[model samples]
Target chain A: MDLSLIIMQLFSGIALAAVLVITALGLTIVFGMLGVVNFAHGALFMIGAYAGLYLASLTGSFWWGLLLAPVLVGAFGMLIEFVLVRRLYGRSIDDPLLLTFGLSYILVEGVRIVFGSDGIPFPTPPQLIGVVDLGVGFFPKYRLFVIALVAVVLLVLWLMLERTRVGLIVRAGARDPQIMRVLGVDIGKVWLAIFGLGVGLAALGGVLAGPMRSVNPEMGTLVLAEAFVVTVIGGLGSIVGAVVAGLMVGICISMVALFAPEMATIVMFALMAAVLLVRPQGLFGLKGRA
Target chain B: MPVYETKSRPAGLSRRKAMMAMSAGVAALAMPRLGRAADDTIRIGFPTPLTGPFAAEARDQVKCAELAVKLVNDKGGIGGRKVELLVRDDKLNAGEAATRTLELIEKDKVHAVVGALSSAVQLAVNEVTRARGVIYVSISQSDTINEVKDFSKFTFHEALNPHMTTAAVARQTLKKGMKVAHLVADYAYGHEMLRGFKRAQASIGAESVGEILHPFGAADYSTFMPRLMSMRPDVLCISNFGRDQANAIKQAVDFGIKQQMKIVVPVILHNQRLAVGADVFEGVVGGANYYWGLETQNKTAAEFNKAFRTANGGAIPTDYGAYGYSGVGSLLQAMQVAGGTDTEKVVAALEGLQYDLTKGPQHYRKCDHQSVQSVLVLESKKKSAMANENDLFAIVANDPGADEMLRSCSELGHAT
Candidate 1:
C-alpha cells in the first residue's frame, strides 16, 4: 500500500511487460502477414534459449549468444518455412496450425532426447549482476537492461515497418497478398523472410529470458500459452497492439498479485475476455482482419 | 505306422472333438507360461512422472531404483528368484498415476509398487495399490499419506514427509520474534509444508508477516516479488518443489529480496541447485533426505555412494534419487528377511525394519510406516567454496530426531 512499494510494483510490471512484448511480437507478425498461427513459436523460443546457452559456452561469451542465437534460430525457421510451412500456404488455415502444433511436440521431445530434461543454468552477464538503486527501491540491473532492450527493439521495429520497403511489402501482403503478387512482389520470398524474422524475434525473447527463468524442454509450454493470450488480446496481427496489450496485461497481473496472488495467472484471461466482448476484433484490429 | 494310426484316429474323430482337443492343448500351454512368469520373477511396479516438469528428478529416481534391482540380483537374487522392475510414466497427474498403478497391478501383476515423485501423485498411487492389497513403498514427500484416512497397512512412506523436513529446518534457522513470510505453491505438498512451518513458528514465537500462494509450475515469480518485499520479513519460507522452487529462489535473488530476508525452502532438491547455479542458491538453507556428503561420516553412506558412483558413471545420487535407492533397496531387503514377497509377511518385515543404505541409521515406524531417518540441514555452498559441480551444498546439521518430529499417531487419526 505504500507509495514506494506501488512504484516498485509498477516497475516490476514493466519488466514483465518487456518479456511479453518481445515474445508476442513474433506471433503477431507471423499471423498478421502469413495468416499462419504458429503453434511452434514457443518451441522456437525454447530452441533460442538452448542455442544461446550452447553458443555462450562454445564462444565463452554471453554477448555472442545474444548476437548469434536469434540468427541461428531464424535460419532454422527459414528452413522450416521452406520445407513444411511453404506447402500449406494455399490450403486450409488449419493445415499450418496443426503442422506447427505437431512440430512443437517434436521440437520439445527432440530437445529432451538430446539435452535431457534437466534445466541448464544460464548465468546473468557479470556487468548486470547487482541491483540498481532506483530511488523508490533497488531493482535488478538485468531487468532494467531488458526493459531498455525491449524499447530499442520496438523502436527499430517501428522504423523498419514504417520506413523500409520490406515493411511496405509485408504490410501490403497482410492487407492483400494478391495485390502484392500483381505488383510483382514475389510474396513467397517475402513470406519466408517475414517468418524468419518473426521466429528470430521469438528466439531473442528466449535468450533474454533464460537467465531469469529455467531453461528446460518444457520451459516454453507455459510461455506459449501466455504468449497466445497476449497475441489474442492485442489483436492477432497487430504489432502495436501486442506492445500495448502486453503492458496492460503485465500491470494487471502485477497489481492483482499484490492484492490476490492466487488470481494473478487468471487476470490476463479475464482482461482478454473483457476486451473481446466490447471489441471483437481486438483493441487495434481492423474490421474483418481476423 | 501303428503309432501314426493311433494319433490319426483322434484326427479322424469328429471335427468338433479335434477342435476341443486343440483348444485344451493351447490353454495348457498358456496357463503354465503365466504361472512360470509368477514363479520366475518378483515384479515391482515403479510409477513416476517421466514426461512433465519433474521428469529430470523422476528419471534419476528410475536410475537409482535400477541400481537397487542390480544390487539385489548380484546378491544371489531374492530367495533365488530374479527381481523384475516394471517402470511406468505417471505423467505427473493424479488420475494418470492411478491409471498407471492399476495397469501395473492388474495387467503387469507386479508384486509390489515403488516410486512416485509428487505428493499428490503418490496419494493416487497409494489408493490403487492399497485397494488391490499390494505393497506400495512411496518415495514422495507428503504428510497426508501417513494420516489414517489415506494410510493402509500395505502403505509405507520411504521419503521424509513435509512435517519432519520443515520442523527440522525451522528449528535450526528460526528464532524468537523474527518476522517470517511464506510463499507456498497451491497444492497438497505446499499446504502441508506451510502447516509444518506455522507449527514451527508458533513454537518459536516468530511473527507471521504474510503468506502468498502461487500456482504450481509458475513461469514468473516477479509479480509476487514486490508484494513479498513489501512485507519486509526477516525470513521467507518457500514451500514448493522442483522447477517451482528453482524459479522462486532464482527470482527472489534477482529482485534482491535475498539481501533483505533469509530464504528457506522446506525441501530443496539436488537437481534444482544444479540447475539454478551456486551463486543464486548461495546461503539458502533447507532440509534434504540425503546428501552424498554424508558418505564422509557414515560408513553405510560411503558404501552406497561407492556402488552408486560405480554404476552411474561417477554421478552422485541426488536427494530424491536417494529415496529411489533406499525405498527399493529396503523393500527388497524386507523380502529377503520375509523369505518371499508375500504382502503380509513383507509388510511385517518392513515395520520396525532398520537399515542404512544411503543416509545413516533408519527404520520404518511401526504405527504409520513413515521412514524415521535423519534430515540433513543443508546450506548451498558459495561458488568459490564448491569443489565441483556436484558439490552444491554444505551440510549444516544432520538431525536424527525424526521420530520426535513426526505427528503423533493419535493426531494422525490412528488408534493409539
Candidate 2:
C-alpha cells in the first residue's frame, strides 16, 4: 500500500471510529449505570435517524434536524424509562431485557409502517458535499465534520461527568446507586437523567450518521451490534474504555477492509472475544462489574 | 349530565357511526387486497418483497401485476375464468418465500405462481414450486435459476438474466483501452454479474485493474474509496441493487470518483435513480431491464405506463413494474395459448412463447426458459434535461436479444 493510501485509510478509520464511540457511549452508560440492557437502544437510534430525516426534509436544514432529533428522542426515552423501565428496576435483569427486546421490534416495525421500507435519501448538504485535501490525500468533508462533532460531544460529555455536581452524582450512582440513595441522593431522578442522556447520545450519533448512510428502519441493526461489541470490548460501563475500544474497532475494521473486505465486520467480534478471554470484565470494567 | 344524555343518544350514535365509517374507509385504502374469491376465476399466486429493503420496488411490481390482472379481467376472463392474483409479502427472506410458496400452492391452490424480486427468494420458491409441479414464473434475474441442477420443466423466468444484461452493457461500455474496477455485492447475483463483466472485458481487451466485493446493504464506501482512487480505473462497475446501488453511487460521487472515472451500473432500479437523484447519475451509462421512458417507443408499454401512472399518482413505471406487468401477461398468455392451466401444458406453451407487453416484443427461450428481450443501455440525462421526475434515462444503446449474449445450453448444464 502507498503511504498516502495508508494515511487516507487511517483518517477513514478514525471517522468511522468517531461514530462508533458516540454510539457505544450511550449503550455503555445505560448498561453501566442502570444495569439494564436496553435492546431498544438500536431502535431508538433508528428513530433518531428518521426524526432527523423528517425534520431535515421539512425544515430544509440539517442543523435543525441535528439539534431537535436527539432532544425529541431523549424526551421519548425519559417517558419510556418512567412508564416501563422504572418498574423493572429492582426486578430480574431478564425482565428489562425481554421488555426492551420486544420494544425494539415494535419500534422498528412502526417506523417501517410509517416510513415504508425504502431508504430515505438523506443527502449530504451542498456545503459538506465536497472533499477536503489533507496533506496526504482527500477526505470527505462531511466525515471530517462528523469526527469533529463527535469529538466535541465526547468532550462536553467528559466535562459533564467530571466537573458538575450532577455529574458527580451520576458517576457515583453508576458505581453504587444503593449507597448513593442511602447517602440522601435522589436515585430515581439520577436514573431518569442518565437514561435520557444515554438515549440522546445514541440519537445524536444517528443524526450524524444519517447523511453518510441510508436512513431506513433497519439502519440501526448494524449499529446496535457494533455498539454492543464496542461496549463489551471497552468494558461495560467505562466511558474511557468505550472511547478507546471504539477507535480500535474502527481502525481494525477499516484496515482489514483494505486487505480483506469480507472480514471487516467479523474482526470486531473477534476483538471483543479476545478482550473477554484476556480480561473477563473487559478492558476498563471494574472487578465485579461484569 | 348522564341522566339527560338520552335525548342526544341518536345524534351521538350517528356521529360515532360516521367516525367509524371514515376510519374504516381509511383502513380499507391502507390495506392492499391480496386476493379475493370470485365466482369461476383462475387464481395465480404472486409473492414479492412487500416489506424490508425491497418494499418500494415490490410496490411497483404489485401495481404492474394488478394492472395486468385488471387488463385481462376487462377483456372478459382468460378462457372465461377471471384471473385473480393472490399476492403475498415474502419479506425478502428465502425461508419466508419458500413458506409462502407452499402456502400459495397448497393452501390457496392457485394455478400458477409469479413474482420474486430477490434472487435468493426466487431460488427458494423455485425449489418449492418445482417439486409440486406447480407452474412458476420468476421476474427476478439470477443466472443460476436456469442451471440444470436448479432448472425444472415447470419454471420460466420472465426477467433477463445477469449474463444478458451485463454482456449488453459491457459490450456498449467496454473498449480496447479501458481499465475497469468492479465493486460488486458479495452474493450469488454479484458473482454472476462479475463473471459476465469479466468475459465482456476480456473480449474487449480491457484490463481488470481491481475488483472489490462489499457486503450487501453496506452503507459506507470510504474504506474502499482510497484504493479505488489509487487504482485510477477508467470505469467503475457497480453490481448491486436497490438501496446498495443508490448508496454506493451517491458515495462515489461524494468521493469525486465519478470525476476521475466513468461509473457504469449494470442493473439500475427505478427507486434507486430517485434515491440517488439525477444530479449524481448525470452522464452515467447503465442498462435497465425496463424503463418507463420506453413507453414512448412501444405502444403496449405506453398503455401500461399511462395506467400505472394514473394508479400511482403520476409516478412512472419502473423495470420492476414492467416485470410484474409482463411476467403476469406472459403467464396468462401461456395459459391462453395452451387453452388450459395444466402445469405441463402451460410449460409447453411458455416455451418459445413470443409476446408483447409494456416493452416491445420479447420471448422465452425454449432451452433455459430465460426471457429473450432487448437490453437497454441508458445514458442518464442531466436534471435539467429530464422532462419529468422519472425521465432519468436516455436509451443510448438497444441491444437486441441475441443467442450469443445468453449462456450456452451446455454452460447452464441443461440437458440437450
Q: Could you say which candidate leads in TM-score?
A: 1
lDDT of 2 by residue, B230-319 (tens): 888999999988888887887788788877899998886667777667877787787788877777777876887788878778877787
What lDDT tens digits, residue by residue, belong to model 1 across residues B57-116? 898899999999999999889889999888999999999999999988887789999999
True-structure RMSD, every candidate: 5.8, 6.0
- Model 2 segments more than 4 A misplaced: B1-40
Worst 10 residues of 1 chain B by lDDT: B1-10
Error of 1 at B174 (Å): 0.9
lDDT of 2 by residue, A153-253 (tens): 89998998899998899989987888997999989998998889889988998998888877888888889999999999999989999999999999998
Model 2's TM-score against the true structure: 0.92
Docking quality of model 1: it rates as medium
i-RMS, each model, one decimal = 0.9, 1.4
